[model samples]
Each structure stands twice: as C-alpha cells, then as structure tokens.
Target: MQPLLDAILHGGPMARRRAMAKAITLLESTRADHRAQADALLTALLPHTGKAFRLGISGVPGVGKSTFIEALGLYLIAQGHRVAVLAIDPSSSVSGGSILGDKTRMEKLSVHEMAYIRPSPSSGTLGGVAEKTREAMLVCEAAGYDVVIVETVGVGQSETAVAGMTDMFVLLQLPNAGDDLQAIKKGVMELADLVVINKADLDPKAATRAQAQITSSLRLLGLHGNPEHAHHDDTLWHPKVIQISALRGQGIDTFWAEVSEFRRLQTANGRLAARRQQQALAWMWERIDAGLKQAFRQHPQVRRLLPAMEADVAQGRVPASTAARILLAAQFGKAPETIE
Candidate 1:
C-alpha cells in the first residue's frame, strides 16, 4: 500500500499513471481485503484530492460526446493543464461486459503525456456512472491532474448522479434536439450548469434555434423551480446555452470561457465549498444504504428463507411487501409473525 501510494504521489509520469490505474482497479475489486486497503489508500489520498476541478459531461448516445471531450481535453492540455478523463461505458446486462472503447475514440488525448483517460464499465450501476468513478477521480487528482472530466454513458434522463458529484455538469445536445419538446422535459436538462449544442456546424440555423429554445426553457425552469434563480441574481450562476462544433474544433475556447466564468461565480458565492460539503454527506448516505442492502442479502437467516420467499412471491402465494417484511424480521432475529 505504501509503495503504491509513493508511486502515485511522487513517481515519474508513466509510473504515476500505472499506479493510478492499479489503485483504481483495487478500489473496484469486490474482495473484502481489497476493500480495506482501498479505504486506507483513499484516506491517504484525500488531502491531495479536491484540488482539481471536476467537470461532468453527458448527453444522448449519438451526440458526439467522445469527439467533443477529446477536443476539449487536447485544448486544455495545450494550455498547460493536466487533464484526466473518466469515461463510463455501459455494461451489457446479459454478459456484464463493456467494449470500453473510449481510448480508441480519444486516440490523441489518450496517448498524451499530460492527459490520462480511464474507461470504466458501469457494471449495472445506474445514473450512467461507474461504481468506483469517484474513487478514480480522487486517484487522478492526487496524481496532479488539475482538470478531471467525467463522461457518462450518455443515457438520457436517468443520467444525473454525475451532477451531484461534479463541480460542474455540462449537458451536450444535437442541433435538432430542440425539435422535440421531450428535450425540455428531461430531468437531466434541469441539472445542467451549461448546455452545449454540439455538431452545430452541420446545421447552423438549427443550432441557433436550439440555442434559443434551450435558453428559454432553462429560464422558465429556473423561474418556476428556484426562487433564487427567479430573481436573476448576478452573484448566483444560472445555466447558459452555447453552440459548438466539436468535429471542427470550433467554439472550444468559448465553452472554456463559460466554464471559467461559472467557476469564478461559484467560488465567489461560496457555493462551491457548500456544494462539496453536501456531496460528501450525500455520498456517505449512499454508501450506507448500499452497505445495508448488501448486509441484508448476506444475513444468514435472510439468505436461508430468501429462496422460499421468492418462490412464494413468484407464485402469488405471498405479497412481495409481506415477503420483504418477513425477510427483514428474520434478518433481525425476530419471528416472521412479528412482521405483520
């Protein structure tokens, strides 16, 4: 553990990248001993973490997210910033595997000495993020990456967890996105700190229309959803809409300018620190809930009765709620009759 820590904290660039990968892999392992060591490593890395700006990017499947990310990453690297991209690829439910082809997609940035890209399988985790993505971000930050980008699996609506964990959430859209009212209705749009219309060069007029429509939608949502936003406070950051052509590498500088402005405003208002505090508490509760569920499943009594209860529920002999109650009672060492 000490050697891995040393490599990650002080090794040369190649060794540091290797150590980061190994540390992230350890964090992803399900073995009990691995988990203990991962926890210790995380504790040691905590002080070095949080220095980097965490940026979360998500969009629908065909929105050219990979292209946009590669362009932005290269642009940042050229400006002397060390960039780390944590790309989440969806896992197959049947086979529980992912193609993990982000490295190939981001050919130049992936091989750059100043950039690190880690493609993680979602592994049945919802919200379009991998289970250990936050841990991986910490590893990258500890390794001196000043900009960390988390690219989600591009699942449309339910792709929201990234916003909670990231300092900024940028949602990508196609030029034709505004043609459907469904885009405005998606909950993911409400969470976006900035909306970028990618591939705008394909249809400039359509992109302009989308920019207007989305800007209006965001304004209306803000007025109705949050009183603070309704006031249009300059101190508080409201979502902005911008157009970009990632394929042509246009508007990347403009996008970065908006990001810088958002960060400046967030820092000035102290919301950045407050947001991190809230996220830390939320992460703790999320982990607790997950741990409790795992413990419930592993409880000897619950495991012993689970098969019969599942059969009963499947046959409609027992209600699922009742079966759940009975299992909970058994896990707590109470008689099943006590559940009712």
Candidate 2:
C-alpha cells in the first residue's frame, strides 16, 4: 500500500493509472482503513486538481448517454486530450447494485491509455452521482487528465445536486419520444448548459423534426411570460442544441467545438472561477455536516441522551424543537457559541 501510495505521487503513465485505479477502489470501499488512506491520498492530490474542466451529463433512461460519452470521449482522446469519465449508475435500493453497466458499454474507452472510465454505484443517494464523484474527479485531474466527464444515471428525476457540482450540465435527448418537449420539467431544462439531440442517423427525418420541436420547446422555456404585461427574469439563457449520431460518430466534432467555446466564454465571463469557489464552500459544509453527524452518534452522552429526548417529544412532555435545541447543546457542550 505504501509503495502504491508513493507511486501515486511520483509514478509514470502506467503507474499513475494503476495508482488511480487503486485510489478509486479504496474510495469506494466501505472499510474505515481504506477510507482513511483514500482521504490522505486525496489531500496529497488536491493541489494538482482543479485544472480540468468538469462537465455533468444526465438524461432519462435509454437516452444514449453511455454511447454518446464513448463517442465523445474517443473524439477528445484523438484530439490529444486525456479524458476521465466518472459514470454513476444509481444503485437499486433493494439490491444495492447496478443494472445498467456503463463500463461494459464503454469497453473501448476503458482500455485506452488516454482514457479512464469508472462506474460508481450511486448507493441509493438522492444525487444521481455518488458522493465520492467529486473526489474521483480530483484524483483523475491530479493524475494529469485534461478533461473530466461525469455521467449520471439517465433518470428524468430532479438532478439539481449533480448540476450544482459541475461546470456545465448537458441534457441528452432522443428523437420523437412521445412529445418529450412537453413532458420535460422546466427546472431540469433550465439546468442544461447544452442539449444534444442524439441518435440522429437512425431516422434522419424524424430526428430533424424532433430537433425542431425540442428547439422550439426550449425557446419557449427561455421566454418570460406574464399576465399583467410585467415580466420578471422567469427564463434562463438558451442552451445550444446540437444534433448527433453517437454510434456513427457524426457531428461529434461540431458538438465538442461548441462545448469548448462555451467553456471559453464561461471562463472569460468569470463564471468558471466563481462556480469553483462555490463548489469548494459547498464541499466544506458537506464535510462539516458529516463530521457532526458522526461525532453526535459516537459521543457517549449524545447516544444516551438521544433516546430520552425522543421519548420526551413522543410523550408530549417536550416540543420537538425544544428537544432539538437540547440535543445540539448537549452535543456541543453548550448552546452553539457564535463568534459574531
């Protein structure tokens, strides 16, 4: 393990890849020892991170997400960019395993020297991606990867969590999927930085019509509507919509060019730096919350006090809010002292 850790710090291409794979495996481990080592490795790797662009791709099931990523990833590698994909398949709560195997679909990219593909089980979390997805991205970047693509499970449910963590959120859609234009939730569409109309070569005519309908629908999303002729900022910027055939490798270059241009504009406008800062702050709070939860559970006094407080509330002897205050005070050994 020490040798592997050392290799991670100063290894060549193959060694680094090996270290990365080991690091990711440790991160995904449920054991405390593995987690501690993984945390240390991540701390060491943090400085080399934040140099790559992080993009999140999400959509409904059967949206060709895995296929599109394979095509796009290969394209990027051909352009001399080292690519890393963190594919998250939401785990089944009953069985706690993945049904859709992203790695199997992306066999080519998985073996490419310039590419690394990791499939993470979502562990029944609210976010489509796992909690460690961000950490995985950092590991890849630290290994000198140029681009990090996060692919979330294709469920049309709310994906605000993944969207908030990425530089750009790409929404993928198919042709003539039963008026998908009307069925898509507005909030989901608003989060999209780019929309790709995939499977274009399967049925060109149908794809074209579907593209037009989706474009028109997205345009409507960008318009501010009001009954009293008073319009608020009820719309977001229109996301670029591109037609692509991921299987045939059509329009991939054009799609990537648009994405690169959007990235450039975002950086020039200062949004990129701003977003990174926000993500950092969010991560800080997340860890703090996790630590607090762990501490509260492990502290002997809190463990004893929790049941008593719950019983008091249940029996109507104490209000739930009052119990919460007491618990907080007990856990911190005081009512939370404020610096301000």
Candidate 3:
C-alpha cells in the first residue's frame, strides 16, 4: 500500500498512470480484505485529494458527450493542465457486462500523456455514475491531475446524480433538446451550472432557438424551483448558456472561458469549499446506507427469513411491510410482534 501510494504521488507519468489504475481497481473491489486496504489507502490519499477541479458533464444519449469531452480535454491539456476523465459506461442489465468503449470513442485524449481516462461500468448503479467513481476521482487528484471530469452514462433524468458529487455541473444539450416542455421539467436542468448546446454547426437556427429556450427555462427554474438554486443573487454564480461545435472544435475556447469564470466566482463566494463539504457528508451517509443494506442481507437470521418472506409477499400471503418488519425483528433477535 505504501509503495502504491509512493508511485501515485511521486512516480513518472507512466508509473503514475499504472498506479492510479491499480489503486482504482483496488478501490472497486468488493472483497472484504481489499475494501479494508482501499479504506486505508483512501485515508492516506485524503490529504493529497480535493485539489483538482471536479467537473461533471451529463446529457442524453447521442448528444455527442464523448466528442465534446475529447475536445475539452485536449484543449485543457494543451494549456498545460493534466486532465483526468472518469467515464461511466452503462452495464447490461441482463448480462451484467459493459462494453467500456469510452477509451475507443475518445481516441485522441485517451492516448495523450497529459490526459488520463478511466472508463468504469455503472453496474446497475443509479444516477448514471459508477459506484467507485468518486474514489477513482480522488485517486486522480492525488496523482496530481489538476482537472477531473466525470462523464455520466447519459441515461437522462436521473443523471442529476453527478451534480451532487462535482464542484461544477455542466449539462450538454442537442440543438433540438428545447423543442418541447421537457426542458422546463424539474430535474437535471435545474442543477446545471452551465448549459451547453453542442453540435451547433449542424443547424445554426435550431441551436439559436435552443439557446434561447434553455436560457429562459433556466431563468424560470432559478426563480421558482429551489431558493438555493436561484441565480438572482449578483454575488452568486448564475448559470449561462453557450453554443459549441465539439466536432469541429468551435466554441471550445468560449466554453472554457465560461468554466473559468464559474470557477472564479464560485471560489470567491466560498461556495466551492462549502459544496465540497456538503458532498463529503453526503458521501458518508450514502456509504452508510449501502453498508446497512449489505449487512441486513448478510445477517444469518435475516437471510434465513428473506426467502420465505419473499415467497409470502409474491404469493400475496403477507404484506411487504409486515414481512420487512419480521425480517428486521429476526436480524435483531427480537419478537416479530415487538417490531410492529
């Protein structure tokens, strides 16, 4: 563990990349011993983490997310910034497998020495993000990557999950994305720090319309959605809309300019530090919920009763609520009636 930590913190580019991959793999492991070591490694790396900018990007499928990310990543690298991309690939629900083709899609950035791209399988995890993505991002930050980008699975709606973990959440949209009332729905758009219309060169007219429509929708959300999300405060960062052609690399500079501004404003307002604190607390509770669920399932008494409870519920012989209580009682070694 010490050796791996040393390599990650002080090794050459190749060595650091190898160490990051190994560390991330260890973090992703479900083995009991591996988890213990991964926890220790994370504790050791904590001091070195949180220095990088965590940028989360999300959009619907076929929105050219990979194209845009590749463009942005290469641009950042050229500016002397080391970038790390944590791309989440959706796993097959039935087969429990993933293609993990982000490396193939991001051809140029994947091979760049200043860029590190790690494609992780979502594995049925909700929120379009992989379970270990946060851990992997910390690994990249500890390895001295100044910019960390988390690319979600593009599964739409529930994709808002990435926003909670990232410092800045940028939502990518297609030109036609604003053609309906869906744009005003209360979800991902409300959380965007910036909205980008990608592939604008394909249809300038549509892009312009989308730019206007989304800008309006965001304004409405800022006014009516959540008080905390309101952009009316001049002191706080207001979300902006921009058009970009990621395929042709147009507007990449403008996009970065907006990102830089957002970073500056957020940092100055102390929101960046506050947001990270909130994310850390949220992460702790999320892990606790997961741990409790795992322990519940693994409890010997609960395990013995679960199959019967499931059968009863499926057969309509027992209410799910009652069966859950019985299982809880069994796990705690208490009388089932006492639970009710």
Best by lDDT: 1
* lDDT of candidate model 1 versus the reference: 0.85
Worst 10 residues of 3 by lDDT: 91-100
Q: Please report the candidate that would top TM-score against the real structure.
A: 1
**TM-score to native of every candidate shown:** 0.91, 0.82, 0.90
What range of 10 consecutive residues in model 2 has the weakest lDDT sum? 228-237
* Each prediction's whole-model lDDT (CA): 0.85, 0.75, 0.83
Write candidate 1's Cα lDDT for 1-340 as tens digits. 9999999999898999999999998988879999999999999999999999999998877688889988999999999999998865554444342224656778899899889987764456653244588889999999999999987655433356678788999999999988884845358878899999999999999999999998998899899888799785889999999999999999999999999999999999999999999988888888788879989999998899999999999999999998998999988888767876
TM-score ranking, best first: 1, 3, 2
**Number of backbone collisions per candidate, in order?**
0, 0, 0
Query: Runs in model 2 with CA error above 4 Å?
Result: 1-6, 30-33, 92-100, 121-129, 154-158, 220-237, 305-318, 334-340
Kindly list the per-residue Cα lDDT of model 3 for residues 119-215, writing each as its tens digit.
Answer: 7644556532445888898899999999999876555434556787789999888888879746544577778899999999999999999999888
RMSD of each: 2.6, 4.6, 2.7
Q: How close is candidate 1 to the true structure, as a TM-score?
A: 0.91
State the lDDT at 166 in candidate 1.
Answer: 89
Query: By the TM-score metric, which is better: model 2 or model 3?
Result: 3
